[model samples]
Target: MYAPTPESTGSSVDDRPAVERLRHGDRDALTELYQRHGASVYWNAYGVLRSRPDAEEMTADAFLTLWTRRREVQLYGVSVLPWLIVTVKNLSRNRLRANQRRTADSLDAADPPSARASAEELAALDEAMALVREVVDRLPAVDQEIFRLCLVEELTYKEAAAALGLKHGSVRNRLSRMRTRLQSELGPRS
Candidate 1:
């Protein structure tokens, strides 16, 4: 996933007047704004959702609701990015609910690893995790650094940025893309 570059704007990037026009059924303005910020919205959705299809769907749903509620919605501020992020979060929650409805799901129990798991099972799980680490280490050096800083050290993006000499946004975008690539390489779960 590509990170959005800062756009050159004399006024605030998300001017209130621009938002008012969009809220008043200005289709062209809506289209323009969507084009300008779609990538950021997608990345925000991807951060929460961790699925391309889910992120895409959440992005679509967010904009659709923005369009649908145009007249009724109030644009209170200039930071449309925050609004879009909040909207995507809400949509992701909805998507998660729908997904939960389809699957037998729970967050209650913490079953220990199988008590009867043999030495073979422990060895296999260890081998699988080691293989995952090897694959991670084989990635581009920047990816390896980002994974280590975030996962191994549990650094927030800002901290990772300072440690690795990368922008926080770049760290976020790289991690998002890395998760998708890893999921694809791993194939479907049993």
Candidate 2:
């Protein structure tokens, strides 16, 4: 869904020669490609992650991936920028998910649950979680992915849209409808 246009890289630069040079173990070709598209790739990562350090790291990782996966890299038209964009997008999302897991683990470790909680309370919590999962499972496949990316993964609307290749408004509207449906199904909290 991400069609590569002449403006995607801010120029009509052909990357075939550079890719060929890279595939032949030419480090200068890698440097050339980086100089050509590094900013676009970094900004793409930053747009998704909103963190300078993470974006910089992801930018480095993206170029590394391009280097390591040189033999397998696929070019769209004459430019390798599309492949780099997709790589950075994936790297940014992975970083986000890992950070989310680390935060959750740290929080859990910081605040051990009170052992004095009643069995009834634990059972109620389990039941509510089960109901939520069941409701989410009933959604269409794309909607289910949207839910996971937006809610469970905590990606911004723009990030989710870029990952899912949907428009920003479309992701926002679908998520709103999904929440409304979920609330209606679950009813008000007592």
Candidate 3:
């Protein structure tokens, strides 16, 4: 619900001549246009954005648009407020869209994965796993047995150690070294 300002309330002369003056590069006419319509433009943008800084920026852009496109200036009856309001709406929408795009870009970068894996990611993971298996298969005999028992069979370190007649700490240390080697071979995760 927009309430008209004091300047907007009383009867005023037609603004077409001022617009025409602005078309002829009259800064006074531009200033007059701002004096007449700036409040409406600022408030319209404020209504949309609910932030003083954004509203002020939109207000400036709206006036800059008027100055840039002065040659094509048109008005409804006697007031430029309607044109300013429409320009503010368009500027506000554009700012909102840009902000949303930036926020979405940030979210995408942070998340890294979608609801499902893409073809490229799945193929890369498969390739990485194949390389890991190759590395495991090439391990020393005892190391290979420990890797299989601890990882493939999902045994606890203590359980694997007991089955293989090794100390629990030795089994843990071996598994840690194997994981480090695997990670180095894999390079980096996505």
Candidate 4:
């Protein structure tokens, strides 16, 4: 269900004019854009974040970013929907990562690591990690870079592609294959 707005006529609308107005500092244009796309943007953020408050906040942030960076905003095929979706996704991911870090810090502070792991347990963990490292190191240089950029750095595929000067599909496919290879290599042995 969507909120009833005068602009929400359930018909495809071109975003170029609104974007141009936004570029020229028209607040009404920004409002029109929001009325047109706010629900979709909020839902996209909610799909990623699963928290209503966070989704709402992210939606607002995405629009704010759109307004602030209007001069630099790029449109794909006369539509701002793609850019808005990507913004919401990135913002939601950042919020989730931040929340995770805060939760981890609080847990660490609350539960000091006074209890030490046994030497055997530590050795096993080290050996498992070393095996993983070896598996990763065996990948091709490009795959390794993909792994580092996508998994370790937590960048979206598009961001990774831009950083590496590769196509989005190439980065996505390589990462998929890399994940499968890693899983197969690290899975329990018969």
Candidate maximizing lDDT: 2
Q: What TM-score does structure 2 among the candidates reach?
A: 0.55
Off by over 4 Å in 1: 1-4, 8-11, 105-190
Per-candidate Cα lDDT values, in order, are: 0.69, 0.83, 0.75, 0.79
| RMSD in Å for all candidates | 16.4, 12.2, 26.8, 12.6
For candidate 1, what is the TM-score?
0.48
> How many clashes does each candidate structure show, in the order listed?
0, 0, 0, 0
For candidate 1, give the lDDT of residue 186: 67
Candidate 3 accuracy as lDDT: 0.75
Error of 1 at 63 (Å): 0.6
Q: Candidate 3: which stretches are off by over 4 Å?
A: 1-13, 111-190
Residue 141 of model 3: what lDDT? 56
Model 4 earns a TM-score of 0.55
Q: In model 4, state the lDDT of residue 88.
A: 77
Question: Per-residue alpha-carbon lDDT of model 1 for 73-118, expressed as tens digits?
Answer: 5555665666666777766655555465445333544456664678
Model 1 residue 37 distance off true place after TM-score fit, in angstroms: 1.7
lDDT of 4 by residue, 39-140 (tens): 889999999889999899889867876876688888888678888888878777766775676677768877547766789999989998898789989987
Cα lDDT for residue 144, candidate 4 = 72
Tell how far residue 157 is off in model 1, in angstroms: 36
Quote the positional error of residue 147 for candidate 3 in Å: 58
C-alpha positional error of residue 62 in candidate 2 after TM-score superposition, expressed in Å: 0.4
